[model samples]
Target: MPHSPMEVTRLTATDAARAARVLDEMRASTLGGGRAKLAPRPAIRESWGRMLHNGIDPDHDFRTDLLSRDEVERRRQTSRLRHTLPVLREGLLSLADTAQHIMLVADADGRVLWREGSASVLRKADGQGLGVGADWREETVGTNGIGTPLVSRRPVQVYSSEHFVRALHSWTCTGAPITDPRDGSLLGVVDVSGPLETLHPCTLALVDSVAKLAQARLRDLHLTSLEQLRAVAAPVLARMDGRAVAVDKNGWTAAVTGMPYTNRLALPKSLAPGRCWLPALGLCSVEPLPGGWLIHPTGDPEPPLTAPHILLDVSHPRRWTVTVSGQTGSWTHELTPRHAELLYLLALHRDGRSASTLADDMFGDPARTVTVRAEMSRVRRYLGAFLDHRPYRFTEGAEVEVLLPEAPLDLLPHSVAPGVVRARAAAGGQAWVERAQR
Candidate 1:
């Protein structure tokens, strides 16, 4: 958030209409819904308040200063996203690495979403108008995937000549929007952009790969359903489609059975037990309906549910949420004392610690170093399949550590241009790669 010297001098465009329109479209595309707009100069749709509250306020200098701490926190998060995003990007980039100068995971709006490329590549794309969460389209930002796909609502490969703007004629871009299957809403776009000379016939393939991976990751994370709730200590009842299903480790669903669900129904149907695999949805013990078959999913020594019940060790790499009830003693997990200790250790030191220290700290004896290391890798490997940016990784000559925020973590863009981060003249992003490669 701290403005570099250039930021203090570089004033943003005061195009309220342009900015407002971009914001409106973002919400509609991401949420699969729109805000009611009233016409007047400088007036935004009421729905925008929630989102506007979150963006970096272009108008306020001090707000950026206040948010400086947030950047530091965000930088820490970048490490996590880096793990998964780079992997996701490989699938995307593998589609057509040469023609592709950059790959990005965009939010609902046309913003950069997320970016992966050498710092030089990112800088070049930025000059060409590409960055995490920036509005892009051949029409808006010139021949680019960001806006074009959003407008078209499909996959597109743009050569320099196809650009809506003449200047974009030299840039080749391909993009595909990743949509939410439940509602068929655009979650974001996977785009590739670079010079026309660098263009390849398979650029569209790259777009598809990125889009697929991002969507898959989102699903694993349980971001797909607003109905899906996450709880640390809430009672859980699993349902398939809409019927009750076997609970997960804590209360994640194995399967659900009963009448075919007509609509979104809560768990704990009194009728009869039927079986079906639970898709994914809300999990508060106190749904509009009664509770489902409560199961003890925790190991021995149990985790203390100071707050009722919550889901533990549910599946990931697809989106899911656990809900805890406000009521006390309604839910609990059975964790072995050792498991609880490990969980507590993770909670206490989410920012991370070297594997050596962690092993010694938890094991309290040098005899179990191999066992501890194996366990640490197991933790990473389990999530490696579905989740991106796993909890543990090697740092400083294979010192294993957990990479996360000190507090609750949110998944956003991560992995900035690694070395020699360059400031860019292009508004979307800086050409870090170009400067760095030099």
Candidate 2:
């Protein structure tokens, strides 16, 4: 009979060799369809299940082709993580080098964009095919620090034999995911990795704390940009006549006149200078500002007479969006992960869901109604009258459409919401499961 699972972090440095041996036995027993004397840690076990479901080979060290150098440069230039490089380097590089580990940052798509730290470990990582431009997604490469945290959306450490791939048993890695604070969009993950002997209990916390600092730096930069936009908006809005507001490209409000101050405006994906219909502001004349847009209410600020059409697209694993069309015009808004989950759940349960019900669907905890309500309020700002409360649902008269991924496993890959998990499970793991069995 197998003993209860052991958390790798609890092991002392002197127990490193023993811990690896035990984990090895646990992994072998689990993978070979036989029970052993030990069980894997919760995160490792869950990650291993995903790996098996996806048909990943535990013995074979599979890796996708490295991205071209030019493509790597292009991604680095465009990634939001580029802006926080200084913060990450300052916080992690020195410690990583001293500990003989390497610090690497992978984009939301799991492509490594930045790498630095101990010279010797860098060479070893190169041998492991973990250099810049490498793909580290869990499906591509068996569960490891970089890819696992991206899916789990939390800090994680894969120590020695805890790694899903058998060849990775000699290494250890700790990583934490970083997200955009403004809208809760995942940016990427920061990871510190080295030979198994260097594994330390504190590494996970250190990586997580530095990742938060990077997020704080990004937030500060956003605030500074908003301040600059506000400076330009104040003067222009002061001269406007009727109800108007100044908002950034992402719909963050900077100034308002003749109307209540809104924190955000929900701009369309392809907004331009002209007459446009906004959910919150209705028919309006839009003019380009320095770093944002100026809006003046034109016709009635009320919704159109006919019912609107809403299309919720969750086909892509990483990006989700909602498009709304009415008699006046059409607009699409990119959704944050949490908003995506709520909208998806509402779309699934067209009859409507109470705050507690939504909480249960999202978090598997009905007591989290306060959090559900807070998120729903933000969703309503852009959705406007199209979404109704007191049992949140789309308006009775509106048309709703949902676009799901072809493969069940691809549906919201980052989401572990109980509802989404159940939906995916209903598909019986689809193609990947078949591929793995073969």
Candidate 3:
């Protein structure tokens, strides 16, 4: 088997020639007969499989058409990744240049949108077709750090011959994926690369750390935007009477009046001025606000207390959907992994859960009520009528059912929320105990 990354790093450090020989053997076997006695590292081998299946030619110097200047500018204007560029450069560019490496940032689609660092490295990169607008997706260019990390959704290092393409064997690259904090959607990847001689085992860790810093900066920007919207909402909500709230375009609650404070309101994909049925607070009149929308509860009488059927499906790897059926009709809402965990927790404890209890469950910290309350507010937007607050709970008349994955371990695969983890552990243990009894 191919040595572990740590072992390879150590070998490269102490016996570079031997390590190189092993890599050469591995590559020769893979390309010539696909019967390499020594396999590459798991990640690299997996990436190679994907590239081969996609019909990528390892010997050919692949280059896809670059984006037009106008299109590139348009992407920069619209991409959230734009806000992270400064953070990435500040964290990486100087060090990368000094180390004879280049720092490159590619969008989710693997299009290199920004590149900088050592001039020599940049020129070498250009020759390798790694310039801005180049498609470096695994299928496009074979396994390299930028595209590989995006596909793996983690930090990855492609060292010398570990790269699937022959042309990339002279270089080493480390990259980490950056995802949106608001949602788990990938924004892009940030990578540091140089000639094979510059391979430093620490590069992957450094890139991963900087990627996290970029995400932190993005979170700060999101919070700042919310604060500004809150400022604009204050005066508007102050004049409102009876249940009204000012919410941003994404339904982040900026201000609320005549009701309990909520973090966000569920909003339709498109907001237009008029009366509409909102999941939370029943029917409401919506009006365009400066940075968001003004929602006013129409004071419609609460529907009869007929038990609504709620089905929480967490079977999918990436998505969770909640289906609600009752007097009006059935509506389904797709939830983020975090929201899925929260809803699952709420369903488990049908009686109710205080903000602090939920915070503790979701984050392992009772003080994280702000985040819990915010997410719950969003949940209410779609299930508001079926939910009740002040120690949030499904309305007493609602019947809740949850659909779990066939394999208990498969539940909420992307969720790191403490509640989901605990649920998984508990279910796994129960399964094991049942097997033991049998």
Candidate 4:
């Protein structure tokens, strides 16, 4: 437990044997409740708690049903991870093949989407149920690299008995989470794994660096998309007379005229040529352009509004609902999980959150403003006059409340947003104390 799993010094043969013995003792103590006096490292112990709570059997090797070949193909086609594969392969596969290790890429749900490397290693992997379509989630397979890193939001290495399931003790693996640059949501995991003899302390650093490269590539892709949108916006803005701006489908500002440039503007859910109230520009006429929408300000002033009450419901796993009530009555909008996390964070800091602060909260990186701006623009579209921005906030006088899941751990289960993670941890701690008292 002295060194983190990722920092375990390159193991000498003697060190490796000792570490193996210690981990084996920890596992025996955990599974049999015997007073085998050894403790797992903090990270592994924490992962073990989650695995036990999730009902994974320590003695059993469990593999959930694999996705159908058609289903697997569909996920690959739609996954943002598709863009990261080349980076992962270039960075890890070559090295892995030489070391007789296998490379694996799994989606956010921990289903292996791609596997490659030494043909012999791959064939060996099949016997351990580590082929494409295999489910490697901690709940199903016990603590290991792929699923554990997703939970920890950091790179991890599981060596020998550090694995929760007894049958996986012969394997050692290192993995890192690949996150979407736009929203910081986990896209999937990139892993290199092999027999115990192949364990290398440097594997964690290699996978971590490659994961970052994938995110950078995603950022480059986003910039390219914006460039294409800007080209489409140029001709449309040339003929405009009033204050106007052109924005892509996601509301990224591509071009602006007759007004100060804003990073982004919120657009209505269904984009059509029509008059709609815009939070940033008051009332505007929205017109369809080639790759985006052109907005022309009508110079109409926004009507004064009474204070409103806002309620965010994040109790459900797959659906998030937001409702606003004001002098004009109440309206509700279903939110995507990403939007729900943003609104919850904003509500937590009602004074308002700047784009950078929100970016940090959502993605764990303050510099990721493009994604934050784009998502906030969409939130504004739905919330309308009830929301305000400079630093984004609910309009003054609005009372905001968030409805959480019944169990703290159930709250936004798939969200890795920093604020959400803190909230979940706080709630979980309180829940545990309550149970202990009972």
TM-scores, one per candidate:
0.37, 0.90, 0.71, 0.75
Query: Candidate 4 regions off by >4 Å?
Result: 1-14, 30-42, 266-278, 303-307, 313-396, 410-438
Residues 33-97, candidate 4: write the lDDT tens digits. 45445445555765775665566777885656779999999999999999988998999998788
Q: Which of 2 and 4 is ahead in TM-score?
A: 2
- State each candidate's clash count: 61, 1, 0, 0
Give the poorly placed runs of model 3, Cα more than 4 Å off: 14-17, 27-42, 301-438
Supply candidate 1's per-residue lDDT for 62.
17
C-alpha displacement of 392 in model 4, angstroms?
A: 11
The positional error of residue 170 in candidate 4, measured at the CA in angstroms, is: 2.4
lDDT tens readout by residue for model 2, 221-257? 9899999999988987787788988888888888889
Candidate 2 ranges with C-alpha deviation above 4 Å: 1-6, 36-39, 301-307, 429-438
What lDDT score belongs to each candidate, Candidate 1 first?
0.39, 0.84, 0.78, 0.77
Candidate 3, run of 10 with poorest lDDT: 429-438
Rank the candidate models, highest TM-score first. 2, 4, 3, 1
Better of 1 and 3 by TM-score: 3
The order by descending lDDT is 2, 3, 4, 1
Give candidates' CA RMSD values in order: 21.7, 3.2, 7.3, 5.7
Clashes of 1: 61
Task: lDDT winner between 2 and 4, please give it.
Answer: 2
Q: Model 3, 146-190: lDDT tens per residue? A: 888866667888888888888888888899989888656678899
